[model samples]
Target: MSDDKDVVIKEYTAPAGGWGSMKGMSKILPKEGISPDVLDALRRQNKPEGVMCVSCAWGKPAKPHIAEFCENGAKATAWELTSHRVTPEFFQKHSVSELAEWPDYDLEQAGRLTHPMKYDAATDKYVAVGWQEAFDAIGAKLKTCDPTKVVLYASGRASLETSFMYSLMARMWGQQNLPDSSNMCHETTSVGMKSAIGSPVATIQLEDYDKCDAIFVFGQNVGTNAPRMLHTLQECRERGVEIVTFNPLRERGWERFASPQSPVQMTVGAPTKISSQYHQVCAGGDISAMLGICKYVIEADDRAQTEGGERILDHHFIAQHTVRFDDFATFCRNARWEEIVDESGLSRNAIEGAARVYMKAERVIAVYGMGITQHRYGIDSLYMILNMLFLRGNIGREGAGPGPVRGHSNVQGQRTVGITEKTELAPVERLKELFEFEPPTEKGWDTVESCREIIAGTAQGFVQLGGNFLRATPEHAAMKEGWAKLPIAVHIATKLNKSHLYPGEESYILPCLGRMEQDMQTGGRQAVSMEDSFSHIYGSVGKATPAAETLLSEPAIIAGIAKALLPDNPNVPWDEWVGDYGLVRTAIENVYPDKFANFNERLFVPGGFWKGNPASHREWQTDSGKAEFNVPRALNASGFAEKEGRFRLVTLRSNDQFNTTIYGYDDRFRGIKGTRMVVMMNRADIAHLGIADGDTVALESDAEDGIERVVEGLRVVEYNIPEGCLGGYYPELNYLIPLEHHALESHVPAGKSVPVRVRI
Candidate 1:
């Protein structure tokens, strides 16, 4: 109830059976047996403690002592702490085929996996076995296949030590397949940033936001996805720093945020003022928007040059520290303004207004998230952002640079510690020099390539460190088929997921310790390092006890596997390193000498440490040791659907959700209550289609191989979104994502751009 004219009051009604009745009931009364304790746990699972809290070990270590968990962190804990248990007895009662029919939530909600289980083809059920026995059996099965047939897939949830050991084992065994979660998320930032600058990380720091005069956030919904960032944005807004947002949907969080931490705002119901100006741009329109900004800057520079005034372009910095400016400038000049306005779904005035703001700001920060990466041209789009930043000598500066807000804690850290398929030349030579073993010089298979190899039956085994690979990847049918084709598949995970259920000829599910669980190694109490989106490296130590004693740390599991594989190597003691994470940190310090100095000492601090990048001071680390500008072409993009009467659909996450997991049914901020079965649309477009507010529609993707997904009887919420754009939650509508539709360089599924025609 703010008196401000910009503040609007909206009323919402809760759906039938309370907020999460349908989802809760679905978990309880599934077509299978349910334990009473499991049911009771599910009923009372919304407590302040449990699995949801355990899973989020990201920024918790750095948080003030009083505040423990965020909303999504609690949801993640609730998800893991569910009372359900899919025991050996339960598995014996049901076949894998039967369990596969159940929804992902129902399958996972069945409960904590108490023992290691292996798929038995004869009984068609997963049978319990001793840990050692399971490991030996897996080892035997792996030995039967060629090392090249095995692919090790890792997730962002894994720690740096675990990832390093996993990579070491894979390399020692001669398998170069390392398909990881980074491929699905921030691979574009990695590839694009490396090409633009020598490093593939954001040069900006969290403290830099305080110094920024203006901020431009593209495609990221900080309110829901990364709530912690909202505090920074709120502080900046309060100080009158100009904030501009570019996204297809005018997300409520970006409009206003009610921080639970603020006593005054919480009591008065005063929400944080979000964007000074919001632009509802079309999907995949980032390139145009960036180019338009550059064009305006160039125009301003020309005016300054002619009038003998202050130059809009940082002429001194650009000349001293950048190359190829003339070529990039020419490309921007040739780009038609009409095309930029039309493609971006922004008016000329809006584009000019944004450009004017960009030109005035001395220190600007452009932050983007998955929405900018999960597209066909994601890498190129990122390059455009770098080009724009380079035009003003923004990169490597105090408050100006490109920031890709990565999801998960260590997605970037995992990549930094040699979890990539394409190993760098320096890392390879360094590994050989350090370990005395010749590392593989050739490029390895990425996620898409690994999946393709699995489908082709060339890859016979898959070993996952963490994550739901099957559910996370595109082409669900092919992903499942690829698993079945494998001779053996091993999943090292904390709990049960759909990916674990995809049985191969031989499959093993090895339960590992969760992030929030105490990890007691030979080092006494071990602390693991994780890198945030802002290139800040920090240590995390779990406060909670282990869910089960049988669970092993990720590093220990990798070391055990490596011990079995490489019985004779002497470069580094795998057992010693596994026992103490500090030993592993020493190795990391040796490998990445430039970034991690005094790695052990620095990690002991509460704030952990920052991986210092001198480039933040405008030191370009590109090929010529200078920031390079990329010139984008105006040729008609090929992947866009040309079908008549079709609009592109962008998949997104709800306030109560994360990737591939639905925490609750209520998207409270979006005015969505009780269910995710709804789509945001432009009111004018919905009326033109003769579709009412509530109607059942089948959305068929324009991609030749894309499947038609039916979101039964969804209520269309008409809002201030761009025309020809639709928004829906992912996984439910993930079926619309085609197997072949992905970004060119990164191969991330084009989850943001799927042309579809809706039919009633």
Candidate 2:
């Protein structure tokens, strides 16, 4: 875009829906109510006007026609149907230099692209190109470079079939460099779950929550991040199940929920109370909290043994299925209570109280999100959760286990279908057996490595299935420069985004069909399968018409590119597979037979199919075939400690926000309406900083790896957050994330921890 920065623009924020108003509105309007703007835009486009149907990858499915759409989905839909248009003429009028001055939202809100375009650096303008020409150009570029030099990046929004075919095509071309969104969010779940159990997925089904005596939630914000989960948490609360929440901030969703499904609850303006006990644990202190709970559970068992002959753990199951009991016990004994209490920011008594709830409950479910996953010692934290669950034999049972609430609709499914950069030998052998092509044995680059490769000039081309990669990634300037250095960049997306603007020497934007849109092919109306957070594979039939006639299905686009690139071969049925997605699923079934059994037949079921994860039932797949207890060392003293008066800044999603997209800036639960500039800090911290509730300040963090980012003019809002922890909305503050701050094992950016000083 523009060489100079400092472009001034007006800011806009949308209004909020009140709890009472929202309750009343949920009745008259469908769960996913159609916005007036959305309806008007559809009518203008000569399409049917109505509420959109939404089924998140999570277990919750909204009603048909009036399905529940999250705030992010609303924003996504609105973004797709924007009144603005960026035709070839618009591109010709403004050079890339001028367009670069515009804010990300302004550039994207300009509207849906009507035709395939290529960036011409000579004129600094994008020129419309025919599909054939674009494909030919891509094929020519691929022919020049080694397959290993090309990195294929998949987003969470990509369908399982598309991801599978994309991965297959890459393998057929002999490249293992398939970096995906998983590297950013739930890689820990994949690595941790697979290490703990043979399969890497949550074992508990949606209905299993009904059988749970108690539910423990950590780090995840059920309302803002995964709103559909609020209903299940509410149901458990109504059924008298104890809900314990361990998070640094008291998220609104964890406090109370108003279910639109229940008529009486909606009419009476009653909210379903959630979280019987809310513990404000320090950020990156989850391991300490979990260890404390385990310590108390062990002490209770010891006391029971002394008094009579009762055991807290499932002794029979542990003895039969596990190894390494004495070693684990020794580690637990060596863990000091003082360290746990200090690190967790909670009293030993509070942890004991929480442990009592865990001990008394026969069936317990612990669910966590990015909060626990986005830390330097995140994997250790995750292992601790598994260890605690295993101690009481809480896995793979009817209602007890560890549930990692994954973001995106089909992120989990993408992994199931083999979108991983690090593919195992078994999958590689299976692929060779099925497709008659030897899959790459080398491990591919992850998100971080991909960037490094691109910057180092080793990576020649980049292709994204979806997602705003530049903004979402750490080290924005470096990432942007690396993208610019690439010879070609191809993006398959539904709407315009910041990533689309960061063009390479020759960039192409291939508009694709959205999940809500119909995909009519030669056979019939095609349906895509998505795996929810719980590992349930279900069919998603698109209802709305395509945003543009030129837009293609993601699979079709990939297949077309592959056809153009690869030499014609009998083994590669590229065209046949594109015509029908079943071929892709069949290949996926061959690769991951343990999980995707009869993938085509099972997807037709109304409620979908569940992938089995044996570890949840105490079937440890570790080296010892038992859950391993990892003793964590104290977190390195934070850099914030060196900065005398600064508080550790933790980025959070607003109730109205999702990821980097701001639907409308209204977080009703936080009493934040029509604004995203607010920062949530503990009252004590605010007082200590000599700042009142409504005072404006600049947030500055220590430069990491010699890179700096300063977010200024943030309005301070006092809330029930832990001391030394400050919360601000993501993406707006994503710049504050230092390039060096990332999880040790997962390589996920530490968005939860940024030492910052607030200046009035």
Candidate 3:
């Protein structure tokens, strides 16, 4: 392993996707042992016998190309279907303490878990155990604990059927304490968008991008995170659609991109320019930047009317489909230009230019990601974007709407399947009537609250369907200590992660099948469903053989535990549901009669069915019976006032990684290699600090919390980042962000912005 201090940074001169992506894939695919059969499986994505790409939540095109997967999607598939195994002999050779010394990448490279294991503290080793024994142990511990003290965590990778069964297990156990990955990623989209547009999901379809006259992307890196979306952007660019972007990094995706799938472009080395205009907004300044754009639009509308030009504001749409327009307009107009310029880190001209592009287009689509949501005022930022769209009647119309692109495959679907901490009354009543179990109706803890509850000793055990909970969450030290002191922790996973290594007093690691693997039950092969970002419910069937024969399907594992926990009660048919997933779909349809009436039948179609959203068709389900504009109150400060030498650090993902999974030790697009622990700082900031580009530095958060939050020995790299703002890889710098420093209403961790002091 190369030293992080000896990192390499090059001038990334190539276009986003063209040859670079293809070359990287060529290197990794063969290394991961992805054969021609896997390529055939990937080509059949979104088909009847194919699984959804286990990557970002970018919706698949209505009529997808023959090769439907993107570079990142292919990497994700290869990462999961790697021809490697962690058998009982491997575990026997390495103790838990020995494995703990290995890096996360090495741990992942150790390969898939082939058997259920129990952590033996005496030997500090994990020993293989029978699936029945693992389930029995978990059930025994669950039976002893108060249901409220049990925290049920779900990851985005879990299928809808699996999530449904897990939700039932939590509810049947007399609790609603189900905190999931969505709480950490896109909860702001749910809470804020529901308040504004009456729906928590994206209103636009995947085909809408083709029809959209203008597209605005904020905070998200489309090239790295959702690479497939770049193909749509390239097409939009060809059609002369205006693309505006606001992000701290002037990402290569926003500049130009050459699609590898395009033979002509790949051959000539010519690329389609994506963003028509790009602005580097400072960290934590998304709200201010959005306000600036809205203000410009409001001013331009007034000017057009005064000068006897064409009407800019949509009066008809405003009167019929929206409310409180006057109040929203007043706030935008009253916003100070100086404050907007200072906070946004963009000049007045740039903001106005973006506004002009927006005003010129009749149809507009606005998309955002965690960078906009993972902030103290994230909900407010979402409202600001909606307010801008409402001003021009962009939403609830053809080719125009808000698109809060969620992270993780089927994350939105997991939420739709009732994997929530707070249980609604109607769902509780339906569960009681259908399954013959009285579900607890009281609200439960979210991700942050669950962590706090565990630390406070209110929670005694934890059970997760997937995800690296300890590394993904904030306050790593606290979570580690809390887990170490817990009475029980159970993980249903495919690979070895940090969560499994650091166990409680009694920990059980249950190995499960991956998405690419076939799940055979008593009946036959089972197909599961997933909902994409656009609310499209579709069936996904795994084609690859199981990585290990001993691995059980996620639904089967959950059913096993359920059977053990509720053996005496004969009301629920766990065995039947696991045998055939159709039974699970039937139950789901019964729970959501209107949304999913003929769920199984719809799977036969090409694109599947659209779970109709009222807001998508201009029907408002809000309290006002219309879309409401919000007037965010003025804030005295955007965040904690750091000292003169301190910087606002924003943690982000690299090109080589997805969430916490590291595919390689390089951020190829950003010209970074062989190191993940590096901070990106402005050249001028580096000069002012009297530090060189390769100098190693330490970062300590400016927090009053008694817990010490510091990350040491991170090399610094000079880049085009905003002054007084720094960028680093996530799950690493997540240390500097305290658990309490999260979005106000949504409680999503403020990973995008943290007050930190950089030291030599």
Q: Write the per-residue lDDT of candidate 1 for residues 178-264, one digit (tens) a residue.
A: 878889877878887878887788888777887998998888887567765666788899998999899888676678766565667
Q: lDDT by residue for model 3 over 497-602, one digit each (tens)?
A: 8888887789988998888778898989888888888988878888788888899999999999988886555767888999999999999999889888888898
TM-score of 3: 0.98
- Candidate 2 residues lying further than 4 Å off, grouped into runs, are 1-55, 60-86, 616-618, 635-643
Give the alpha-carbon lDDT of every model: 0.73, 0.72, 0.85
Clashes of 3: 0
Q: Of the candidates shown, which would achieve the greatest lDDT relative to the real structure?
A: 3
For model 2, how does the per-residue alpha-carbon lDDT over 24-46 read when each residue is reduced to its tens digit?
23332242244564554333221
- How good is model 2 by TM-score? 0.90
**Weakest ten-residue segment in model 3 by summed lDDT:** 633-642
RMSD of 1: 6.0
Question: Could you tell me how far off, in angstroms, the CA of residue 255 lies in candidate 2 after the best superposition?
Answer: 0.5
Clashing pairs in 3: none
| Model 2 error, position 668 (Å) | 2.6
**Candidate 3 CA-lDDT value:** 0.85
lDDT score at residue 619, model 2, on the 0-100 scale:
61
